[model samples]
Target chain A: MNRIFKQDVDNILKDMYVTSEMKSKIKEKAYSQNNKRIISFSKVAVCVAAIFAFSACVIGATSIFEKVKEKLGNTYETGILKAIPPKENTIYNNISIDTAAAMTDGNSAVAYIVIDDKETVKRIDDTAKISKLNINLVEGNNSMGYTVESVGYDKNKDTVIMKISIDGKNLENKEISLEATDIMSGLESKSYDTKGYKISDIINENATFIEADKGAYNTEEGTIEEYKMLKPDEINIPINNDKTIYISNCAIKDGKLYVQYKYKAEIPNQGSLYFRFNSGLDDYYNMPNVVRNFSVSEKGDICTDDIESKNGWCYIENIFYIDNISQSKDEFLNTTIFTEYDYYKNVVRGNWNISFKVEKLKDVFEGKCNIDINGVNITRYSLSPIGITLRGYSENENVSMYDIDPVVIINGKKIHIYGTSSSEWILDEYKNMEENIVFKYSFSNVTNISNAEKIILGDKEIIVEKN
Target chain B: MGVNIVQQEYENYEIHLDELMDKYGNSILRLCYMYLNDYNLAEDAVQDTFINVYRSMHTFRNECNEKTWITKIAINVCKSYMRKSWFKRIFTTDTLKEEGYNYNFNTNIDRENIVGEIMKLPQKYKEVILLYYYYELKIPEISQVLGIPSGTASIRLKRGRERLKETLEDWYYE
Candidate 1:
């Protein structure tokens, strides 16, 4: 480019001063990160990794986003808006409050936040699912919470406008503070203590118990061996007199039990056939692919996979992580498992039981990584062609966690870990693992383990297979 | 005791931050303004960029020049804003135009001022031309900042210069 052209582009937009207001807010956010008191152990490592991926996987959320169907009331009218200082806004990631003001009548307040775009909108929404937006109205001694009331894309303005609303309350002479400090994780989810109800209590013997021949792990990795019932039990529970839900063959691999079942619903079916919850919220065409995951400690955790309302039939595949189901046979089957959908008053109660044994796989490569992260020693490292596990222990001090994205870089290329249902790791560990945590990384088709170079574990790269 | 030390640490940070501001503050904002072609939006972006820089100060590997580091961060911030700009445009009115902000620079009329012409160029070419000439980054350095290969950076630089040359020729001769 010529000097004249260069000078011209260089002098396009004049520089502006960095206001002290932005600096103070930045300091506040930065300090919160610094002053963090407690760190929760990462429960799902794969889910955590997926968050860092380019675009978050938008499973069964074809509903895309929840809209603000509520009518804009007087609080949103231009006449009611009383100008407030710009301090009300606090920006985070991709969402920022553009216009924040109180109402003239002091009954309610509104703030408009502009989301960066759809990708950012997804991230914010997904992240907010775990950690909600930390927006609050500070009124004297009484602090009130605000909700994302309505969302619309102002096509004329080219911004995603999210209208935030505070509860209608008198603020005649209140120095109200509407501050969004940071987005916090732990958007709370409710887990219920499932009460027991027998099959006889819920349904009659007309329901069909589906069965299959000897079951192998769903896919043929050969390394990921599956357990099948030597003699499949005939299980048929009638939803009603005319139809029944059938349970068939099953397989277990990498701490998860996959039970395949099918149900035939009449187009004009009379009985209410209750289906079990599995998988995550990854649904398509109102029918989600089975990815609903539930967690159970010695206790139980269940993510409502999906409920597909088709014209005739509903097929179900329930996979439970063997690790999470740490109880004995009697304890597990006797233990009541509750799905999230049970919260909906009208939904069929899908509380179910588990009783089966799969011939488990033999360890392909049971070993340890000869390294440490910060201070913690990584012991109990093992690998099958199907999966790899890395567990660490620190007796004296807490282990400083690193992003342990387990990949076997073989022949100058990387083979990454496959999907996971649930896991406990350094980042999101329970207090027990604060001093000791186990990281489990599973792969789908890793045929051989001895064919690679070194495995990258943050700074502590360990040579797994020697050339 | 910990609180005291943190405050002291922040005090030290403030001093260092001021020095950084003196060096690259206005330049970074100017760079963003050129990229975004909007004043207020660029200001907001620069504010966020500095915040990011402050938070990630410990993470800067110092593998490249501080200017390159700041410029890289600024470009990323501007791109992110632009990424969501199309969405923002629909709701927000053109406050800049409403305020009577114009692009005219009173240069000698004999020579065509290239600001409007450069702004009108496709974004890729415009960015490369500005980075090479205005920021004075070499093609390799520009690649590092833009996260593109050096070969691609070179081609863009050449193409951008040729386009600017054609534009100038059209303005002056035609």
Candidate 2:
């Protein structure tokens, strides 16, 4: 009986049985209107193709062009070059203050304290002479420091507020409560206009300038300063000026800022202008030339001009002459000439001019150049002297020469080329400027002369002889 | 000539669909019934399996036989139904027990007692045994439907048999 029972349980679990009604229900559900529609659509497509093919054969032969067009259309195409809309530039300035020095004059006290817990009386202490200090927080600890903890109207009362524990417990007898008048305040901010700049051209180095409160004494009730924390609109400093403006913690994005400044008439016609931005101990300069003229038009046209400083002196002779003006409503034309000057007046260097039209009104353009020094080979079908075709040997067939290189030469100088690969023969390097080496070849009309010397790249000179 | 051939192929597919439904519809329904423990839901799952099979019929490479393909569809449908949030809420134990069908066996042993013992087995062991013994599929065939190695299927069957024997022993001893 036990053996029979085990066998029955196995049979009951293993055998799956369904009634006629259930099968009918499944068939009914499977052949629902939605399912039928999908199957019928597939069948119709196949029928349409068959009928189309039969009708085409009966009428006439299909052209190879049409067939190729259909084949290419069916193939997946992707990676379209998208046009990105140009944006306005926004500048941020950092303002600095000598907090330790300010506090020593009885106006403020710089305190660096790390609170391990706000509820507990524990803190990491450090002294920062400047208003800003680099603090690295240890994991699982709450830490921070204030340049001025608390300020009081009375000199004696101010000392008490500064000495009070940050944890809010245990106030010393000498400690004093902070009054609104005793609060120390200073200014730190930088600004630049987006009218002629790309977001990349705003230099962050040495961009900070600080202004401290003026009143030393006499007004014991405390002082309210108007324009006490002013950031200068113009950052003009003499060549030998020892005072350095330090700018730290700076970021640039797309936006607008008010730019109110007159161009210094002593600005040079050529060379490059460097804006020294003081950031802490190390000074930084915004390399405006490298960043300008970075983008190209939809027709693959790019300007080869470098935008120069409007305020400084530059060599004017090397500046490119603008032959034509094609202005769009959204576009702005900006041109600058850098001067070789010792103190903003003395001249020393040669000048180069860049003239390119841009679509957007930006203060800075982050453009780069590609100079191909190797000679370009001109083909018979070429429209310009810069047009060159390089043919690869026949183990590979039908190679489009456009894939070889994209560098276009304007007059005699090489310029920016996008989306094309350089040939192995061309040597490429990017330093203060990007350079490309191109090979120049000319085909002779007459029979080959035995005395012709082959041109060697990099070092060997080509010998040209009359045949 | 190609047009005539294409017409003949469509006629063949129509006949094949009818024969397949007649042969495997009942077995697929039963597989879903055992998996979900609900007859109405099991019937819906079986129907969904056939619809999907028909829609994707063009892409079906004849690597496996028709029965294996249908069984795969049925298993996938049941698993999908189990994953739905609403299914869990509707199929709680108290509700399941109320609706569960008791097999009326005419012996001194009660049918509900037997079913109770079977349901107590782990889901994996219980599923394999039900597919193997009730569905009457060979171990190798069960492996293909469940997408597991044949060795694993055999092990599941062995463990299931052992568990069933132990449950019987404990009941008898008590």
Candidate 3:
């Protein structure tokens, strides 16, 4: 029974999960009166046209871009492209690379390629994902790594707008060929977005690792890095009634400063530090701040047996790479560091002269939770100050939809996971392959884990029997 | 577990929220998505609608149908969302030059899907078709939801059907 609307779509609409947590959120927000709203439609009449131009592009990242979707009001591509005004309008065979010079950002590239606009717009409503054009950005001699980021169309001009991102650091290129061999389409990807997941989906096999640059982590020019271990000593810390970082262990080695300290607080704290590396430079010049490459192991080992660049900068185990960090004494003393732990708005940051060098690194605390999820032996392999790690074995190459719930239930309250490290792959279809998958997830305000009751994975509950 | 008095009062709101979500959540989401053409945006507008529903709960005087009341709220919320100028600025023509950051605007159910075909229709035709067919409202109810005369609703329905026939003639004849 196909009416003007299709049955399958109605089914899809009906099947959109209305979660219990979402209901709770609605209840909370509904009771609260704060509702700061969006920009109105009339003032931005141009956006309505962009909406038409971007109708095809709307299929991607719908979940992420829902907040501003109203701007996507009624319109077509012609009004959108004309509003932006394209640069050099070049045409290829039947496929015209309409405009290339009009846009330039260091990280990405966009090309206005002219094709049958009507066919493309029609095809957009007909297909799931846009077909990627067989176009590549080549340097003078070599081809650069890039992928089709987005493809939109302009109905008025009959152009396929292709936006691509260049791989690696450098994005500076002047002239590049728009090689349109065939209309490449149909590449589907499974997006592992946490926002799309429930709080309990912390352990979902869809819980893939987020790969970001480990930051400007390079080999320091010396044989041994300025490794220094501070002894357990009481240095004068400007004590706050609410927060105190009592250093229990401190070390500077392998191009990273490690501080392990017990944080006692009357109130919960979520904070980040902004620091500069004292690399014996003449003055404080801004080096490419590569703080992300710095990893942390506040309690247990955030770094697993997998030799990788995570858990603060270097793993406590094998912190070796490119040339040695045998630093001169000048490079060592100039390394006098400063870090601050500021609580929520009321308290200004205490830029404690941590080089006052009395606080210690918190003791390495480890926790393990063994639970059976849907008969699969999944393990909360380890819990540290930083986060928890999940492990499971599968005889079949992959697991089922069972891996999505990543929440640890403590006293009936859901504790969601942040992100993780380890060799955990997506659950693809395979037959006789076997692998031990590990997922290390981080969370907020989890100071201790002695009270965790169970890990909820869908309907299957794994009682966390701590061993 | 001993529930506190304040928590018990909060539970009433929670129960209502769940009931409202279960009853009309999907339909509102579908309607919003149809109007906005973006999945995430529709979800947000629906969320905003529920918030308003709760805010105006005491004001719901039982005059209009609750579903119609909710749908009207959703439509207004969506229209309010469409007004912002940022969308054009973000995805400007220059956006064609950059790579990596991209959002697909396609519906999960394409043209073969009824909602998909309805989306393909002109904006003027969209509201009437959604209310008349999808929401299953009578012409008068549609007129009330749209704040138009029943005659206008009927005319829009007639014109909407005529346009649908021109596009979906193959299906209509079959």
Candidate 4:
């Protein structure tokens, strides 16, 4: 090799030499005395003690549990009754709302009452009633109980008659009379609108009015109804003297509402309709079915398949699924699967499944013989007719599975038959199937099996030596 | 005879300490010097590196050669030391002063100007250049020390050299 001469190289080497010499002196000064002292007494004494304590606790508990279980019969009836306390019936009370007085207190001179009795409460809910009432409570003070401006039960029908006064003169009376069934059903359902109402008459009582403009009214009934407007804010009244029935907490949130009322006898399902008109458009529509179920307790189940778009667009984002297997109303055990779907209907992200199961060995190992495969250490061993399955997570590759070869070496001889062949074994085989395999085996002939202490299969190994 | 024995033991300690210091101390100091560009900080980093090596000497397996092992320790120490708030504040401010320190030395044809320009390169390019050219390390060795693929190290070295040439061209023309 040719000798290379570079000034920069020479400077760097010279600096390195000087630095190294200085480092040695510093090292000796910093560590020589301490290093000798540290070696004299083990530095890991505390850590070793902590590990020993933890191991002893775990081992002690395991052995104690084994002895106790052996002493006491492991039968389900005996063990469960001994372990768990008896069940008790818990009584729950409902909010009793004085329907008659609540309606009379609100200055509506002529009140349209719908009492939610026990039957009504059982069929529909308080939330539905409050939402319906809010639609009728218009923002105005009138002589006849806030002048029943516009009313709707839900998104289907509305009964609203607005008579506008311009310059202290009555101009027009626009009356919207919806079909009776739509009106009744609107009151029954969770939401309602007035677009299905038939306009019977639009009389300009004040003929000399300067302008007679028509405006549109949109209601929760999912319909847009046109109305003749004589003037804007023509229906003004004293804010303090307003006889409107104030219905607070009536807004729909998370696809459900809660309402309350009091009644002695079962009140048949009955409700009122409300509507609003502005520019031939309906603002209130059916809420989306994204939230399939609602429960009082925090522990409840949710179904993602029933998700439907409100108004044919928009979806719930950041949705989380909660599963309470013990208390879930669904038939399936408590298994929560969280998922996020994009606007294009693709599951963009989320955990696929989180579940746990317990099964008896008799049910798992049908009649198939258990086989401990050679050259592999089964972290989790299960046998079925198809093959033996091993469950383990790889340090290099995440989660994976492996199929154990039917034949395995034990005490120098290859044994093919291990587990019994039965229905239980078949079920175990199918249940343990996984998407990816983690280990592979290669057989090598050896004269003395006792001499072989360890077997390597792909990236994993098994130790045959006794401890 | 007792006095002579004590004197001989003292000599032996001195020789052993000196030999160990000569072999590893400069390498550790040079690594820190390259990163910090300050003699005192470089010496401190080397001190820390040696202390760690001495403490862990018993656990040191004969996996890689001792030089590589010590170099790895020094690099890790320098990285951690650089993370200290005081060290970062001091070094970042010092970089500005050192920016033009080499500028006056390039009087012949602006060699100092070339050095200043090299210092202005991005940290990644500067590290590659210092490791490859200054330390006389091949691309593969640089890759291993830096914990990057050899191909990536080679590419960075080539790009760094080209950038240095480009930066020097402006001074040369002037």
Candidate 5:
């Protein structure tokens, strides 16, 4: 059987083979990329080894800086992205924040910021996330909109390196500030089996029918509508650890089940809980036929004051619209409520601010094009050393702007835009059309546009020099 | 070593680009075609994989064979393409017809059914199945390629075979 299967496989893939043309294209692209950058691994060997000791199990001998670059698709092996030391690695509340490095291509900029809790008594693991982080790359009156995303966590250093990307504009000769008040870590999940319990066993006389201020999704209308949802004051169920976190209330209304979770407020806002119904089977392979819809709504606490003490504890409610609730309520009872909550792990409460200047590595190519891609207008675009950012307008929300693979051809060698880290579509209320549908596509390899050819979007090809 | 040293090593080892491509190019392309059902995406992934292999040629510690190491890179590149939202939005089953890659085999009826069933399997199972059966990689090699433990790889292979048996009625496995 195995031999037959193998033969079958070979026969199935018989037609698929790397032709001479494909081999030539692949070799040309790979070697051209190799010729652009000199491969030198010995220079950062010592520093990379020190960082690797902590994350040796995860990534072998690869530097954390390279990991950050890989995460942002800026994995160009070059000295073009220069590293600038922070003015002062600020330490507060037993935690430290420093700008590890930053670079730009005269278009957009990316900075690697390290938040370390090495001296703190709290433990930092892979689940560590810096919450309520506000990053501003300011130059005079122009403040660039940025997104701070976590690259990965180094368990050895008890630190997490975050990539703050400022897009849509040039960010050279500017100072960027990263301010965050809290670091949430150790996120975990717990499952509670609802084997023998029924719906009436939880909902009692104290249940109040209130307006769904949280907004419940109506399956029939296919829109969020005002429904009289039943809100139980107390679930009256014995939760072993009721002090830290518990399901405050749960009820069924309009064929939907609503469950509220309450977390005790800690000094650093310890626990924020969420609830989900598990299918009670193995992932993917054992997926059931029943597809349910659910929405989450959190109340009482805001993320602005990440560490400030709020007036009350945090309350998170999950509203699940059970299809054919009358018939499937029994089946739903067999499901488990998996309440995911993070422990009071390595949460440090202090504003660790860092302002750093980004140096431009190379001159960028910026141009405008009047191209239409399946009813979506492609207007302006910017090509940087790291990646390409295209700004366009789309009147139709149903039509995706990414209708075709955007191929950047340099000297006849075509490089596909592998993935996009960010794509922002802002609604233009005045023009009545979304003018700024920004798609920032990063190249996996170093892209030099000096001798570029053209960019193919959908079926239309736009000459780089003409555009 | 500096890049100039790498250039020297490339010449010293006689790792000719044409020779290396001849040895691994077809295998990697077939692996990528199975991994990513799209011919165009798989072609791009093949290029990216070779590019990565070229970039990290110096770091190829003999922990595993050259095939396993290169296969691992190819799988990672295919996964990166899979993560893109445009990958799903742009490419569909209709794409194979549109691109004229002969994605659906018109040769053998039974063989086509088996290959189609294997492709229809979830990514988690299909990956292990292809690596184990088609590539003839050992459990450890599959584990290294997928970045999972050997025991987990075995379990996935067993489960994936069981899933195939359930779906393919006339199919037999030992």
Candidate 6:
């Protein structure tokens, strides 16, 4: 009887097999889940390791003070920065959000927040990040530019630490509220290689081409970001795929190779695609610069409630000014198209909201200096134990704030400062800076700025004056 | 540098997943089909099983056989799917017959009757009987998969066999 039953069950299931499409879906999901944290791994290897170490410390943390200390780094150990006690134990949707620590020099403020998923099986995956986030003052005109950085994730504890840095303007002695509606995770970067298919041959065989409406380049002028409308019967080649973003078109015209890609925007799963063509002699770093542009919507159509709406199709094209495409046809064919797909595999929806009062620290140096170097003027500056912000601008259209790498001479030692953020260049209609390009420089280390004698801006040194 | 390590680990994980699916995909599908009594739900169960297996690969310490470990995961996934309130509301024997008929099973009438009667058994007995007969798992392995003691698995298997015999008395007694 068992034999008969076994045979019958086997007969019914022998036809059942996992399809290739299903396997692909499973593999895609797994890949996205595992590699989400590794997106910034290449750019910041040491930072990633530090985050992991901090997360390890967070797992064993019993007191909120210890958690605050860990997020603030060893700066708290040196007694340079004071930790602001946080309002903890806010739970929603099986997730806990706690403001771990906060400190301000009255000019700038930084807050460390931790999100802990209290579930047996963790939904806060490696790529989990906040979306639809809003931060504002409770009872004042809140005009704060803040940067939220996800420090890292602890797999064992199912926790994520985020640091929010805000420009302190009327922030002291005020209630700051933060709310995030959703947490998005599982970002995947996929590459599609069109190997063995020569671009020239594909164009010749199909014999189909349309003039590109956007992303046309002028090699002589060296202006890559110029927009031009499509002429009649434009040779715009379109490529199709079964994914979110793909290389929609490719063609060679006027000593330039144009690769147009269509991406779906204003959707839950957003993606952007780019193409890189190399000579195969060196890595892609040596490749020529890619000029790019996009088509301005004629109808000004916006995305409807329907996710599959065609109104979401946005076209972005890249133009490579290859020296000679006829000679480098092989190199063009070997180019790889990469699609950075940002998707939320799991979205924990809830009001992750918290409000806390800002604590102002007394140790801060705020000043204004009249210093000029390389035709660029430095007007004002601020130095806190945590960071430094310098505001300046250059009328020499070529000199951006990016060119100014300031060095702080503290206690007879010159310490180079890295830029954390900068304001946009007040550009004219010609895209040339009309006014100053203000910049803010934030150092990674906790510096004893009180003992600093002078700051070397560009090539000129200015004495640090108290305001 | 860190990217290369992660890329290597991801490649290895993908290969391991492919091997697991190749080895046990069809078998788990069959097991889920027999447990859920619906082919579509069984297919979904198979996908969920492999996804869970891939996610929890790090937690698997070779205490028992790899097959036994995977079977336990698949069984747990099937049980979880069965617990959903929607599963009870939408699932019906008529839908099962209609879906099963789509499989085009061309077996002997008596063997088909035996398969139907075994599926009709209670959830407790049906699971062990299918694990024992269709999956050819030992009582100890069935105990691990079902999270039951060996004695209970044996009792359920025996009683499941008796019930199937009573339902198809002519075929079993013959």
Going through the candidates in order, the fraction of native interface contacts each one reproduces equals 0.15, 0.16, 0.19, 0.14, 0.24, 0.24
| Tens digit per residue, CA lDDT, model 4, B1-174 | 012111234335445334546665655555565555544455556666666665556555655445555666676566554434334334443542321111111111122454445555655566667666545566766654555456666776777777777655543321
TM-score of the second chain in candidate 2: 0.71
State the TM-score of the second chain for every model.
0.74, 0.71, 0.79, 0.63, 0.77, 0.78
Best candidate according to TM-score: 5
Per-residue alpha-carbon lDDT of model 3 for A347-382, expressed as tens digits? 111111100001111211234445555334564354
Candidate 5 runs further than 4 Å off = A1-77, A120-122, A140-143, A189-244, A251-258, A267-312, A317-324, A327-345, A363-382, A390-400, A407-416, A419-439, A444-467, B1-174
How big is the positional error of residue A275 in model 1, measured in Å on the Cα after superposition? 36
Clashing pairs in 5: none
lDDT of 5 by residue, A225-283 (tens): 54454443356453335455655677765666766555555443365443434444310
Q: Candidate 3 chain A — worst ten consecutive residues by lDDT sum? A: A352-361
What tier of docking accuracy does candidate 1 attain?
incorrect
* Local accuracy of candidate 1 as per-residue lDDT tens digits, A277-357: 211211001111122211112222211222332433344444444332222333333333222211111111111111111
lDDT of the structure predicted as candidate 5: 0.57
For residues B18-130, what per-residue lDDT tens digits would candidate 2 score against the true structure? Answer: 55666777667656665666544655576677677765566566565566667777776675555342353345324322222211111112335554555556555666776
- Tens digits of per-residue lDDT for model 2 on A200-301? 233233433233223111111123321111132334422222211211112221221111111222222211222322222211111111111111223433
**What C-alpha lDDT do the candidate models reach, one value each?**
0.41, 0.31, 0.40, 0.29, 0.57, 0.57
Per-residue lDDT of A134-247 in model 6, one digit per residue for the tens? 777778746455656666566787877777766555467677877776676655544334442345543432323443434444432335343432221123333333454545
Greater TM-score among 1 and 6 belongs to: 6
- Chain A TM-score across all models, in listed order: 0.24, 0.17, 0.24, 0.14, 0.58, 0.56
Query: Model 1 segments beyond 4 Å from truth?
Result: A1-12, A15-467, B1-12, B85-113, B168-174
lDDT of 3 by residue, B1-174 (tens): 122211234436556666778787877877877876655456567778888877666656556677777777777667545433233223222543232122223323455645667777654467778877777778877766665557767876877788677666555533
Candidate 2 is scored at a TM of: 0.27
Best by DockQ: 5
Going through the candidates in order, their DockQ values are: 0.06, 0.06, 0.07, 0.06, 0.11, 0.09
Worst 10 residues of 5 chain A by lDDT: A282-291
lDDT of 2 at A197: 33
